[model samples]
Target chain A: MSPLAALSAAVRLEVVRLATVRSSAVLLALAAAAGAAGAAALCALAERADIGRSGLLEAVTGGSASGLSVVGIAAALAGALVAAGDARHGAERTALVLVPRRGALLTARTVVVAGWSAALAVASLLAAVAVVVLWPQQQLVAASPGPVVLAAPLLGYVGLVVLHGVAGLALTALLRSAVAAVSLVVAWPLVLEPLLGSVLPPSRWGAVLEGLLPAAAASRLVAAPPVAAGTPWLVGSAVAGGALLAAVSALVLLAAVRGARRDA
Target chain B: MIEALALSKRHGSRPALDDVSFTVPDGVLAALVGPAGAGKSTVLRLAVGLDRGSGAVLFDGEPYSRLPRPAHAVGVVLDPRALHPGRTARGHLRSLAAGAGVPRRRVDEVLEQAGVTGARRSRPQHFRRGAALRLAVAGALLGHPRTLLLDDPLTDLDDDSRAWLLDLLRVHADGGGSVLITASRAADVLAVADELVVLRRGRLAARGPASDLVAGLKAGVLVRASDPGLLAGAILRWGGDVEPCDDGALVVTGLDMAAVGEVARAEGVAVHELSRRTADLDAALLSLELPETELLPGANPGAVPGASAVPA
Candidate 1:
C-alpha cells in the first residue's frame, strides 16, 4: 500500500478505537453536564445581575472559549487517553507491531485524537447554543452578536480545544505516562500559566509566554467576560495564543519522529 | 521468508539476545525452543521491529519498516495477553484490518478461520485463554501476510486446539507462507517445525532440520516381564539404567532390544512385552551430540516447554 493509504487506514482505525472505548461515552456525558451547568449559571447571572452581551456569550460558551474549565480539561483528558490508554493497557506493543513505522503510528494517533477533541468542542458549542435559545438571556444584553461575529469565537474555541488535546497527547507520548501528561495539562491554566501570566510584567516576555498558553488564547477568543471586561491585553494574547498553538503542533510532529527512532 | 541476521538486543546492562541468527524458509514452519530467558520472545519482537535492537530482520529480504505495507508482508502476534481487554474480538480485528487496508468483511473471515465464533462481539477478557489465543492468531492473519512472527502462540492451547492450530499453521506453510514461532515445549512444537532452532542461555545451541535433531534421541527399550525387578537387576548389571514403572514394567535406558533379549535369555527370564522408546523433545535436544546418559532421569518435573521452567 502507498504511505498515504496506510496513513488513511491508520487514522480510520484510531478514530474507531477511540470512539468505541467506554471512557469516550463517559467523557461525552461529562462534557454535556459541564455545558449545561455553564449555560444555566450564565443565564441566571444574566437575568439577575445584569452582566450584558459578552457575559451572556461567556456564560453560554462556558470557559471553553477561553480554553479553561470543563470543556478544555475534557478535551485534554480525551487526548491524553488516546496515548496513555495504549501505554497503560499494553496496546502500544500491538500497535507498534501492526504499523511497524513508529512515526506513522504516532502521526495517525495525533490526527485522530485531535480531530475527536475538536469535534467535542463543537458538541459543547451546540449545547451552549441550545441553552441560549431556550433561556432568553437577550433582554439583559444591550447587543447580541451577529452570525458572522459569532463564528469567529466559535471557530476559535474549536481550535483551542484541539490545541489543548494535541498538547495532552504529545506530552503523554513524551512522558509515557497519562497521569503526568494530564497533570501538566490540567495544572497549566489552573495554576502555572495563569500565575506566570499574572506575575510577569505586561511586557514582551509576558506576551510571548501568554501566547504559548492555550487557555489564554481560548480565553481571548471568548474575549473574557463582563467580569473582567476592561482587561487591555485581549487581542495581543489571542493572536499570540493562536500562533503558539500552531508552533506546539509542529513541535509535536518533530518530537514524534525523533522519539520513535529512539524508542520504537 | 523471515531472516534475522546477527540480531542483538540488550536490556539495561544485560544482553537478552546475542548474535541470534536464523531463517524460517518460505513454505515452512520453524520453532525457536529454549527454557525461560533463552530470548525466544526477543527474537520475534526484534523481527517485527517492535523492540529496538542491533542487526537486521528482513521479511522477504526487505526490512519490515521498509515495506509499503508491513502488515501485508509480516503479521505479528507478540503477546496474547497484550490484547486490549475492552475490545471485542471483532473490534480488535477491525482496527488492525483497517490499518492493513483490508475490507471490513475480512475481519469476519479471519474470526471464522481462527475458530473464534460468536464471541467476536464480546470482550476478550471474558474469553478463555484458548479463545483469546485464537483471537490473537486471527488478528495476525488479518493482513494475509507472507510471514508470521508468533510469540508463544500455543501457550494456553488444549490438546484439540493444539492439533487445530498445528493444522492451521501447516496450511499457512503449505500455501507458501513462512511461520516463525517461539515455543518452549519440545514434544508439541517440535513435531510441527520444518526446522528447529535450539537456544540455551541466550545463544544458538543448535539449528538444523527437525528430523536430524531427533536422530540421536531414541535411548532404549521398554520391557515388561514376569519378574520386572529381576529383569531390571540383570539389565542394570548389563550397563543399562532402568526405572520401574507403575505398570510393573521396566523402562530400560542404554540398552537395545537384542542385547536386552540376550540378557533375558541368559537369565531364563521370560519377557511379556518388549518395545522401543525414543527420547522426548528435551532429551532429543540434550542428547544431540551429547551423551545419551543425560536423559534427565525419570519424569522431568516441570518439563513443559515455552514455560519458565529453566534448569537451575
Candidate 2:
C-alpha cells in the first residue's frame, strides 16, 4: 500500500485508541465544566452592571477567553497523556511492531492530539454558550452577539487550544514520559518563564522576550479587554499568537518525529 | 517464508547480534533457543523493524517496513504484558484490528480462538499471566498474519496453558503459517518445532532441522523386569548397553523400545514395566555438550544450504 494508506490506518488506530481512554473523557468533561463556570460568572457580572449589547457581547467573549486558559491546561494534559500512554504501559513495543513505520505512527498521534484539542475547544465553547443563554440574568441573555463578532473569538480560542495540545504532544513525544512532560509544561509557563521575565531589566528586548514566550503569545490570543472584541488589537494579537504558535509547534513536532525514529 | 539476512546489532562496541542469518520456511514452526542475554529479543525487535541494525529481515521477500500491510504479513508479540492497564481485552484487540485495517469481527474471532473471550470486557491487569499472554496473542492474531514472531511466550505458563499454546502454534503451522518463538529452554519448543536456530553469545551456534541437529544423541529405554539379570544379559548379547539401576530397573541403550520388548518375550523375561527415556532428548535439542559460556568459535554465522552444524 501507499505511504498515505499506512498513515491513514495509523490515524484511524489512534482515534479508536484515544476514544477508549477514560482519562481523556474526564479531561474533556473538566474543560466543559471550567468553560461553563467562567461564562456563568461573567454573564452574572454583565447582568448586575446592566450592560448594553456590545458590553454584554464583550463580557461573553472575555468569559470564553477566561475559560480557555483552564481549557488550555486540560488540552495540554490530554495531549501529554495520549502521547505517553502507550509507553507508560509498555505497549509501544506492539505499537511499533504493528505500525513498523515510526514516522507514520508519530504523525498519526500528532493528528489525533490536534483533533481532540479542537473537539475539547468546541465542547468548552458550547458549554459556555449554554450557561450564558440559560443563565437567569435577563439582560445578559438578551445580548446575542453578531455572527462575525462571535465567530472571531471562538475561532481564536479553538486555534489556541489546538496549538497548546500539539505542543504538549510534541514535547511528550520527545521526552517519552508523561511525568517529565507535565512537569515542564506546568513549570515553564507558570514559574520559569515568569521568573525569567521578572529577572530581566525593563527594556525593549525584555518586551520582545515576553511576547515570544508561549504563555504570553497564547494569552494575547484570548486575554483581550472586555471592550476590545472585533477591534484591531484583538485581530493583531490573534495574528501574532497564531504565527508563533505555528512556528514553535512545527519546530517541536519536527524534533519529536526525528527523536522517535532514532529512539525506536 | 521469513528470511533474516545478516542481521547484526551493536550496542556501542559490544555486539548484541552479530551477523546472524536464518530462515523459517512457510509452514514451519521454528524455535530460536538461547540463554539469557543471547540477543533473542533483539533479533525479534530487529525482525519487525522496531530496532535499527545493520541488516534486514524479510517476510516473504519484502522488508517489514515495505510490506503492503505489515500487520497482515507479520504479527509480533515481544511482550505479553505490553498492554495498557485500563484497556479492556476487547478494546486492545480492537485497537490492533484498527491498526491492521482489519474488520472488527476479527477481534472477536481471535479472542475466542485465544480462549480469552469470556474475559474480553475485563482489563488485562486483572488477568492471570497466562490469560494476559493469551490476550496479547489475540491482539497479534487480529490481522490473521501469515507469520508470527513471539518472544519468550512459553515462559511462566502453566501446564494446561503451555499445552494449549503449543497446540495453537501447531495448528497455525499446519495451516501453512510460519511460527518463530524464542525460549531459554529447548524442552519448551522441542516437541512442536520443525526447525531450530541456536544462538550463543550474540552468535549463531547451530541452524538446521530439529531432528538432524539431534542426531547421534542416544535414546534409551527403562525396564523393570521380573528377570532383570536375564534381560540384561540378553540386551548385552544383542550389543545394547545395559545398566542396573538402584531401583532394580535396567537402563537399556543402543536398542529401540520394540527391540527390548521382543528380546524380553523371546527370553521369557516377564516385563513388569517399560518406558522410553528422554533424558538425553532435552540435552540433544539444546546441544548441551557446549558449556554455557562457550562461544561457537569460527562458526558459520551465515545461512547453511541444508542441514549442517558443528557437532549438533
Candidate 3:
C-alpha cells in the first residue's frame, strides 16, 4: 500500500480499534448518557427558573448556567480515550511499522478522535431532545423547542466538541501517557484554568483570560447565558482559541514526527 | 538481503551495542544469539526502525524507512506487549491487515498460519503466554512480508510449537525470504540458519556460516580427573585450550576426545570421567536467568563465551 493509502487504512483501523476496545466503547456510551442526563436536568430547571434559565429549547440545546458543560466534558473524555489509549497500551510498536511514517498515523488518530467526539455531540444533542420532549409537558412551562433552537446552538455545540476533542488529542500526544494525559485534560481545563479565571482581576485582561482559556472558550460556545454575546471579544476569543488549537496541532504533529523518528 | 552497518547504541553511558554489523542473505534464516543483555533486541529494534541508533539497517540495499510499506517488506514480532490487551487476536490482525491494505481474509489466513485460529476470538490478555506469542506472530505475518524480524519468539513455546514455528520459517526461507530471529539461547534455530551472529556484552564476538560455528567452534569435551587442576594444566601444556569448570572437571577444547585422553595418559593422570560435551541452550539460559550465586560453578562466571561452550 502507498503511504497515504496506508494512512487512510490506519484511520479506518483506528475506528475499528476504538469500537472493539470494551472500555472505550463503554466510555463513549457513558459520555453520551451523561451529556443527555445533564441537558434533561437543565431543561427541567429552565421551566421554573425562567429568568436565568432562558427557556426549554435553550436549556436542552445549551447546558445549564452553572457547573460543567456536559458536551465539553464528555467530548474531552472521548478524545482522551481515543487518542491516548493506544499509546498507553504500546500498540504503536506494531502500528508504527505498518504505516512507517507516524505523521500520517497520528494525524489519522486525531481526526478519528475528533470524529468520534462529533458523533457523541450529535448523540448527546439527540438524547437531550429526547429527554425534554418525552417528559410530561404539564411539568414544564416552556418545554417547546422553538424554531430558533437548532441553528445557532448547533453550530456552537459542534465547534465546542471538535475543539475539545482536538485539545484532548494534542495534550495526550504531548504527555504520551493516557492516565497522565486524561488527568491533565480533566484537571487543567475543569479545575485549574477555571479557578484562575475566577481569581483573576475583572478587567479587559480578565475578559481575555476567559476568552483564551480552553475550558472557558469551549464552554462559552455552549453555555446557557452566552458570555459577551456577539461582542468583538468573543470573536477575538474564537480566533485566539483557533490559534491555540493550531499551536496544539503543531505540537501534536511535532511530537509524533520527532518522537517517532527517535527511539519508540 | 538485510544488512546492519556499523550500528552503535548507548543508554546514557553504558553501551547497548557497539559497531555491530551483519547480513541475512536471501533463503537464509539468520540467528542473532547471545547471552541476556547482549544487544540482540537492540539490533532488531534498530533494524525495524522502532529504535534509532548510529547506523542504517538496509533491506535489499534500501534503508528500512524508505520502504514506504514497511509491513509488506519486513514482518516484525518484537515483544508480547506488541499486541493490545483489549484487542482480540482476530481484531488485532484485521486492523493491521487493513493498515497494510491486505485482504481481510488474510487475518484468518495468518491466524491459521501462526496456529492461533482456534483462539482468534479471544482477547490476547486472556491468552496463555504461548498462545499470546503465537497471536503476535500471526499479526507479523499479516502483511506477508518478505522478511521476519522476531525477538525471543521461542520464549514460551513447547518443543512441538517451536518445531512448528521452525517449519514455517523453513518454508519462508525456502521461498527466498530471510528471517532474523533474536534469542539468548538459539539452539532450536541454530542448526537451521545459514548464518549465525554471536554477540557478547554488546559487541560482535563472531559471525560466520552456522555449520562452521556450531561444529568445532562450540562443541568441546569435558574430562574429570583425580586433580582437575593438574589435568587442565596438562591439556593446556599439551596444545589444548582448557578452562577450569567448577564441576571438578576440565572443559577441553581445540582437541578431540582421543587427544584429550592421550594428553591425560601422557601426564600419568588418573582419568575419573571423560565424555564429549555439547552445550545445551537451556543450560546457557540457566546461566543467564539465574543469579550469580545460583549458577553452576563457573558455568557463566569466569567462563569463556561462545564456541568454547560445547553444544549438543
Candidate 4:
C-alpha cells in the first residue's frame, strides 16, 4: 500500500480503537456535562450580582457558566488520554512495526487527535449557544457570534489540545509508561505551570515565555474581553506555548522513531 | 531470498549481535537456532527494518529499506503481544488487511487458517498466547508476502498450534516463499526446516543443510551392555570414539547405530539398548560459543568470512 493509504488506515484504526475505550467515552461525556454546567453557573452568578448591566456574562458562559470549565477540562483530558493510550495499550509498537516511518505515524495520530478535539470544541460551543438562546434573560444583549470571536476560541482550543497532545506524546515516549506520562501531564499545569508563572516577570516578554507553558496557552482560549492591560503578555504566552509544544513534539517524535528502530 | 550481511548490533557498549551473516534462499524454510539472548530476535527485527543495525538486509535482489510497501515483500510477526488490546480479532485483521492492501475476504481466510475464526469478534486481550500467535501469523499472511520472518513463533503454543504452524510454513515455503524462523525449540521446528543456521553469542556457529549439520557433529549411538568396559575397547579397536555412560553403557561416536550394534553383536556382547543419538541444534549451539566482540562503527556486521564488505 502507498504510505498515505497506510497512514489513513492507521488513523482510522486508532480512532476506532480510541472510541471503544470506556475511559474515552466517559471523558467526553464528562466534558460535555461540565462545559454546560460551568456556563450555566457563571450566567446565574452574573445575574445574581447585578453590578454589571450587560449580557457579557451570558455570552462568556455561552448561556450557562457551568460548561466553560467542562469544555476546557474535557478537551485537555482528551488530548492527554489519546497520547497516553499509545504507550498504555502497546499500540505504539504495533504502529511502528507496521509503518516504521515515525513521521507518518505521528502525523496520522496528530490528525486524528486534532480532528477529535476540533469536533468536540465545536460541539461545546454550539451547546453553549443553545443554552444561552433558551435562557429567560430578556435584558441580556445576546450578540451573535462574529467571525473573530468564533475563530479565536476555536483556534485557541485547537492550539491548546495540540499542545497537550504533543506534551502527552513526548512524555510517554521519554518515559515509556502510560501512568508516568499521565502523572506528569496532571502535575505540570497544576503545580509546575503556576510556580513558573509566579516567578516569571509580569512583562510582555514574560507572557510570551509563559505562553510556552501548556496552562498559559490553554488559558488564552478562555480569557474573555474587557481587555486586560496585559493583553500582549497573554498573546505572547499563547504563541510561546504553541512553539514550545511543537518543538517538544518534534523531539519526542524523533526519539520514538530512533527507539523503535533500535529495538523492535 | 533474504540476506543479512555482516549485521552487527550493540546496546550501550555491550554487543547483542556481532558480525552475524547468513542467507535464507527462496523456497526453503530456514531456522536460526540459538540459546536465549543470542540475538535471534535482533536478527528478525533488522531483517524487517523494525530495528536499525550496522549491516544490510536484502529482500529478493534489493535492500529492504528501499522497498515500496515492504509488507508486500516481507511479512513479519516479530512480537505476538504487540497487537492493540482494545481491538477485536476481526478488527485487528481488518485493519492490517487495509494497510497491507489485501482483500477483506482474506481476513476471514487467514482467520480460518489460523483457527481463530471462532474468536474473530473477541477482543485480543482475551486471547491466550496460542490464539495471539495465530492472529499474528494471520496478520503476517495478509498481503501474501514472499518472505515470512517469524521470531519465536512457537514460544507459547500448544502442540496442535505448533504442528499447524509448522505445516503452514512448510506449505508457504513449498509454494516458492522463503521462511526464516528463529526458535529455541529447534528439534520440533527444525525437522521441517530445509537448513539450520546455528548461532551462539551473536555469531554464526554453523550454516548448512539440517541433515548435514546434525550428522557433522560428534554424534553416534548409545549402546547399553552388561559389560561396558569390553564394549568400549571393542569400539576403540574398530576405530571408533567411545565413552562410558553413567549406566553401564558406552556412548560411541564416529559410527552409525547399525555399526555399533553389529560390532557389539560380533563381540559376543549382549546389547540391551542401542539408540541413535544425533547432535541437536541446542548442543551444536553450545559447542560453538564465541567471545563477544565490539562492533566497529559503520561496518557491515553480517558479512560472512571473506565476503566483500558493503559500505555501511
Candidate 5:
C-alpha cells in the first residue's frame, strides 16, 4: 500500500479505538454534565443581578465563559486515557505492529484526538444554548447573536478545548505514566500557574512572564473585550494565544512520535 | 524466508543476546529453544521491530520497519498480555482487523479458528491464560501473514489447546508459510519442528535440522534379567557400561538393545526384558551446552548430518 493510504487506514483504526472504548463515552458525559452545571450556576447569578441572564448566556456562548473549565479538564483526561491507557494495556505494541512507522501512528492518533475534542466542545456549547433558549425568561433567545458574529468565538472555544486535550496526550506520552501526567495537568493550571502569577509583582516584566504560562495565555486568547480591559494580569493578546495553541499542538505530535520511537 | 543476521542486544552491562544468527526458510516450522532468560523473547522482539538491537531481521527481503504494512507480511504474538483487558475478544480482533485494513468478517473467522468464538464478547480479564493465548493467536492470524513470529506462546496452554496449536502451526508450514516459535524445552516443538535453533546463555549453541540434532544425541538400552550379576559381567566383558537401578533393571550404555541381548544369551542368562532406552533429548541438548570450540569437537560428526551446525 502507498504511504498515504496506510496513514489513512491508521487514522480509521484510531477512530475505532476511541469510539469503541467505553471510557471515551464516560468522559464525554462527564464533560457535558460539568458544562451544564456551570452554565446553570452562571445563569442563576445573572438572574439575581438587575441586568438579567441573557448577557451571561451570550458570554457563555461567546468563549469568555468560566463554567467550561470542567469540560477542558475532562477533555485532557480523555487524551491521557487514550495514550497512557494503551501503554498500560499493552495495546501500544499491537498498534506499532499494525503501523510500524511511528510517525504515521502518532499523526493518526493526534488527528483523532483533536477531532474528538472539537466534537465534545461543540456538544457542550449546543447543550448550553439549548438551556438558554428554553429558559422561562426567553430574553436569551431574542438577544442571541447571528452565526457570523458567533463564529470566531465559537471556533476559539473549540481551539482551546482541543489544545487542552492534546497537551494531556503529549505530557502522558512523554512521561509514560498516566497518573503522573494527570497530576501535572490538574495541579499546574489550577494551583501552580495561579500561585506563580500571584508571586510576580504587578509590572511589565512580571506580566510578560505570567503571560508566558499556558493557562494565562489560553485565558487571554478568548477573554471578552471588557474582561480583557479590566483584568490587569491578563497580558496575553490574541497573538500569544495563537502561539500557545500552535506550540501545544506541535508538542503533542512530536512527543507522541518521539516517545513511541524511543520505546516499543 | 526469515533471516536473523548476527542479532545482538545488551541490557546495561549484561549481554542478553550475543551474535545469534539463523534462518527459517519458507515451508519450515522452526523452534528457538533455550532455557528461561536465554534471549528467546529478545530475538522475536527484534524480529518484529519491537526493540532495536545490533543486527537486522529480514522478512523475505524487507526489514520489518520498511514493510509498507508489517502485519500483512508477518504475524507476531510476543505476549499474550498484549491484549487489552477491557476489550472483548471480538472487539480486540476487530480493532486489529481495522488497523490491518482487513474485512471485519475476518475477525469472526479467526475467532472461530482459534476456538474462542464462544467467548467473543467476554473481556480478557474473565479469560483463563489458555483462553487468552488463543485470543492472542487469533489476533496474530488476522492478517494471514506469510511468516509467524511467536514468542513462547505455548507456555500457558492446556494439553488440548497445545495439540490444536501445534497442528495449526504444522498446517501453516505445510501450506508453504514459515513459523518460528520459542520454547524452553525440545519436547515442546520436536513433534512438528523441521528446524531447531538452540541457545545457551544468549549465544548460539546449535542450529540444524531437528532430525539431525536428535539423531546425534546419545542412546542407551534398559535390561532386566533373572541372572542380573551374570548379565552385568557379560555386558562389562562386551565393553558395555552398566548402571543398576533400584528396580533391579540394568541401564547399559555403549551397547544397542540387540547387542545386550546377544551378550545375555551367550552367558546363559535368563533375560526377562530388553528394551532400547532413548537418551533424554532435553538433557542431551543441555549437555551440548559448552563453549563453541568445546561443543563442536564433542559432537558426533557421523550421527548429525550437519555436524558443524549441530555443535557436533
Candidate 6:
C-alpha cells in the first residue's frame, strides 16, 4: 500500500481505538453537556438584562456565547486525553515499533484529533442554536438562522479547539505522562493566562499579547464580536492563537521524535 | 535472512550488548541462548529496528529500517505487554493488520492459527501469559513477515502451549521464513533449532550447528555408586569433570561410559548405574557461559590468569 493509504488506515484504527475507551466517551459526553447547559444558562441570563426590548429579545434568542469557553476547554481536554491515553497503556511503543517512522505516526494522530474536534465543534454549535431558538424571548430577525453571523466565529473557535488538542497530543508525547499533559493543557488557560494578564497593561499591545495565550485565543473566537474598537484585538488574537498552536505542535512533534528514537 | 553487525549497546557505563554480531540464513531456526541481562532482548530489538544500535540490522540485503512496510519484512514479538489493554484480542489483531495494510481476513487466519479464536472477543487483560504470548505471535505474523525475531517467547508457557508454539515455529521456518529466538532455557526449543548462537555478556561466544556444538563438548558417563566421593575422585583423576546428579549419581565428563565403568569395577565400586550421557543443548549452553571479559580480547585491564576463563 502507498504511504498515504497506510497513514489513513493507521489514523482510522486509532480513532476506533480511542472511541472504545471509557475515558474518551466520558470526556466527550461532559463537553457536549457543558456546551448545551452553558448555552441555556447564557440565553436565560441575556433575557433578564434591561438593555432594551429589542436588544434583550435578540440576546436571549441568540443563546449564551459564554458556553463557548467551556466548550473550548472541554475540547482541549478531550484532545489531551486521547493523546495521553496511549502513553498510559504503553501503546506508543507498539505503535512506533510497527510504524517506525515517528513523523508518520504523529501526522496520523494530529489528523484524527482534528477530525474529532471538528465534529464536536459542529455538534456543540448546533445544540446551542437549538437551545437559543427555544428561549422565551426568541424573535425572528433578518439573521434568523444565526449561521451567517456565527460561521466565522464557529470556524475560529473550532480551530482554536483543534489547536489545543494538537498541543495536548504533542505535550503528552514529550512528557510521556497523561496526568501531566492534561494538567498542563487545562492549567495554562485557567491559571497561567490570568496571572500573565495581570502583569500586562489592558491596551492594544497588551490585548495582542493576551491573544497569544490559548484561553484568550479561544475566548476571542467565541466572545460576542466587539462593537467598534475591539475588532482589531479579536483579529490579532485569532492570528496569534493559530501561530501558537502551530509552533507548539512543531516543537512537541520534534521532542516526541527524539524521545521515541532515544527510547527505542 | 537477518544480520546484526558489530552491534554495541550500553546502558550507562555497563554494556548490555558489546559488539555482538550474528546472521541467520533464510528458512532456518536459530536459537540465542543466554542468561538474563545478557543482551538477548537488546539483540532482538536491534534486529527488529525497535531499538537503536550503533551497528546495522539488515533484512535480506537491505537495512531493516529501509523496508517499505517493516512489519511485512520482519515480524517481532518484543514484549507481550505492548498491546493495548482496552482492545480485544481480535480488535488488536485487526488494528495491527490495518496499520500494516494487510487484508482483514488475515486477522482471523492468524487468530485461528494462534488458537485464540475462541477468545478473540476477550480483552487482552483477561488473557493468561500463554494466551497473551500467542496473541503477540499472531499479531507479528499478521503481515506474513519473512523473518521473526522473538525474545523469550516461551517464558510463561505450559507444556501444551510450548509444544504448539514449537510446531508453529517449525512450520514457519520450513516455509522459508527465518526465525531468531532467544531463550534463557534451551530444553524445550533447542530440538528444532538448526543453529545455536550463544551470547555471553552481549558478545557472540559460539556460532554453529546445534548438533556440532553439543557433540564437541566432552563426552560423559552417568555413574552411580554407594561411595560417590570415591567414584568422583577416581573420575577426576582420569581428567574428567564430575557433575552431581539427582539420586546420588555422577555425570563424568571427558571420559567414555565403558572406561568409567571399567575404572569403577576395578576399584571395587558397585556399578549400579552406568550409561553414556551425550552432551545435549543444555550442556553445550553451560559450556558457552564463559566470562564476559573473555568474549572481548582486551575488555579486562587486569591480566589475572584463569580469572576470565569459565570451567567447561
Best by DockQ: 3
Best by TM-score: 5
In order, the interface RMSDs are 2.1, 1.4, 2.1, 3.2, 1.8, 2.7
Higher-ranked by TM-score: 2 or 4: 2
- Model 6: residues >4 Å from true position, as ranges? A1-9, A19-24, A44-70, A134-146, A199-207, A228-234, B218-230, B236-251, B254-280, B283-289, B292-312
Please, what are the lDDT tens digits per residue for candidate 1 over residues B1-312?
Answer: 888898898888998988878888899899998777888988887777777889998888888777887777787877777666667778788877876777889999999988887888888877777887888888888888888888887876887778888888889899999998888776768778888887765666667677765654445688988878788888889998887878898888778889898888888899888998766777545433232222223223112232222221
What ranges in model 5 sit over 4 Å off?
A1-3, A50-68, A138-150, A198-202, A227-237, A246-250, A253-261, B221-238, B241-252, B255-277, B297-307, B310-312
> Model 4, A180: alpha-carbon shift in Å?
3.0
Write down the DockQ of candidate 4.
Answer: 0.34
Candidate 3 per-residue C-alpha lDDT over B207-256 given as tens digits, one digit per residue, 9 for 90 to 100:
66766544433467988987777778878888888877767888887899
DockQ of every candidate: 0.49, 0.49, 0.53, 0.34, 0.48, 0.39
Cα deviation of A66, candidate 3, in Å:
5.6
Runs in model 3 deviating more than 4 A are: A1-3, A46-48, A51-67, A138-150, A198-202, A224-254, A257-261, B218-220, B229-242, B253-272, B279-312
Q: What are the lDDT figures for the candidates, one per model?
A: 0.74, 0.76, 0.71, 0.67, 0.76, 0.70
Native A-B interface contacts kept, per candidate: 0.61, 0.67, 0.63, 0.31, 0.58, 0.38
**lDDT of candidate 5 over B1-312, digit per residue (tens):** 999999999887899999989999999999998888889999988887778788999999888878877788898887787766667788888888899888999999999999989999888876877888888889889988999988887886899889988999999999999999999888888888999898877888778888877777667799999989889998999999888888999989888988999998899988998898775667756655554555573443213335345331
- Candidate 4 lDDT, A126-184, residue by residue in tens: 66556655667733434433445444554555455445555555565666665666566
Candidate 6 residue-wise lDDT, B223-267, digit = tens: 889789898888888787788977788988778878888778877
For model 3, name the residue pairs that clash: B278-B311, B278-B312, B279-B310, B279-B311
Show the colliding residue pairs in model 2.
Answer: none
lDDT of 3 by residue, A1-264 (tens): 466776786797777777767766666676668656866776667557653424553455545223245565666666776656656667776677676667677778878877887887777777777776676652443434344533454556666666667667776666765566657666776588878888888999888767666665555555433433455544654565475466467757776766665677
TM-score of each: 0.83, 0.82, 0.84, 0.80, 0.86, 0.84
Better of 3 and 5 by DockQ: 3
The reply for model 1, stretches above 4 Å from the true place, is A136-142, A194-214, A224-238, A250-258, A261-264, B221-252, B256-278, B283-312
Q: Write the per-residue lDDT of candidate 2 for residues B14-127, one digit (tens) a residue.
A: 999988899899999999987788889899988887788988888999988888888888878888887787678898888888888999998889989989889999988878
